[model samples]
Target: MSIAPNQCTVFVQVWVDVNALAQGSTRGCYAVSNRSQQSSGEGSANLHTNVITSSNVCWTVLPIDPQYTGDFSITNVGAESGWEQPPAPVAGMPNVFTGKLTQSTVGGSVNSNIQFSFDGDNQITVTLPVTITPVTQ
Candidate 1:
């Protein structure tokens, strides 16, 4: 089940909200794995090899809270691995961006909305619900 150009191959959404961390809010980690190679469990019996065209792949993140304003930095966690950061626009296969949220400080709970756009208008938004577990130190 190979995906043709302008075709939707796989759609994924995930929620992550870590309570505790080793290096406060300045240090943490997040990771995105490879998309499954199997096609839809139903329909076609043939297995689809996941291939990101790079040109068609993109990942974007935005804070759900309009008032919340802080440094929302992302880093490439997978270096030795083949996985890398998403390329800037004007570039093609869909790409995946994965990294931990880095900020000077974060208080209370917050939410982040992630969107993966493909085939122009076709897209998906993955929600990340963040909850900072209070620590007594």
Candidate 2:
């Protein structure tokens, strides 16, 4: 994740195909997002569901960041952990997940990878290339 070195927070948006995963033979889905702590010696991230569809399926989403501390879990509105899988197959629009990154302190260049797993067997991973550089005042 490449971001302004002087910032306090990092924002990330992820789009996923829940319908495709649900309609398939898979039984679950996992969505993930990652970000590094800013130069301020604080790091954290928040996640939320943006797009919506029918809630007929079940899923589990978790974060896998190395520098994560405390609580930073996100799930669908009616989901139990992280986000819920759609009840039925979706069409046209895609499911969206949003996240915020915070760190305990400036940890140099960070590489965060957000992953989405479906049906326990199918999985997809997305990486956030964050580049932090010193900014002039």
Candidate 3:
């Protein structure tokens, strides 16, 4: 029996509550993804996916308060060997961030964190946990 390769694109949406931040609270910020099972912390989510070998992951930040203007960046916390570093924001999609995952021979289970930093008058950074399991083809 031949096992087919599993490949997919995961989209993670990041929501920022400007009013809450203005009021000195970071709890309003949160992130959710189509493949995520649960959410955690301020602007964090737990992603569980079977597309381990090659997957396209993207994150887009949406501010609750339109008046709020700022910039954000993705920082790698502890990604494994198969994980590819996040590249610069896409030209047309300024708010979108993306990365990729390659196949790893020295496998186990892949656990990683993708950290996002929002820069404005006050900088707020959060971590999103991602868990990926390799699929044999």
- Candidate No. with top lDDT: 3
For model 3, the stretches where C-alpha displacement exceeds 4 angstroms are 1-8, 22-25, 36-44, 77-80, 84-94, 104-106
Off by over 4 Å in 2: 1-9, 18-108, 120-137
- Which ranking of candidates, highest TM-score first? 3, 1, 2
Clash count list over all predictions: 11, 29, 0
lDDT by residue for model 1 over 71-130, one digit each (tens)? 232222112222222222212323334322222134321122233221112222222222
Question: Model 3's lDDT to the true fold?
Answer: 0.57
Residue-wise C-alpha lDDT for candidate 2, range 1-137, written one tens digit per residue = 21121231223433333443435622223332232222221122223222112111222233333333322222232211222221221222123233222221342322223333333234433332222222221
lDDT of 2 at 62: 34
Best to worst by lDDT, what's the order? 3, 2, 1
Off by over 4 Å in 1: 1-56, 83-137
* Residue-level lDDT tens digits of model 3 in 73-137: 66543354665643335545546656565665457655645566777677776666655555553
Best by TM-score: 3
lDDT of 2: 0.28
Q: lDDT of each structure?
A: 0.25, 0.28, 0.57
RMSD of 2: 16.1
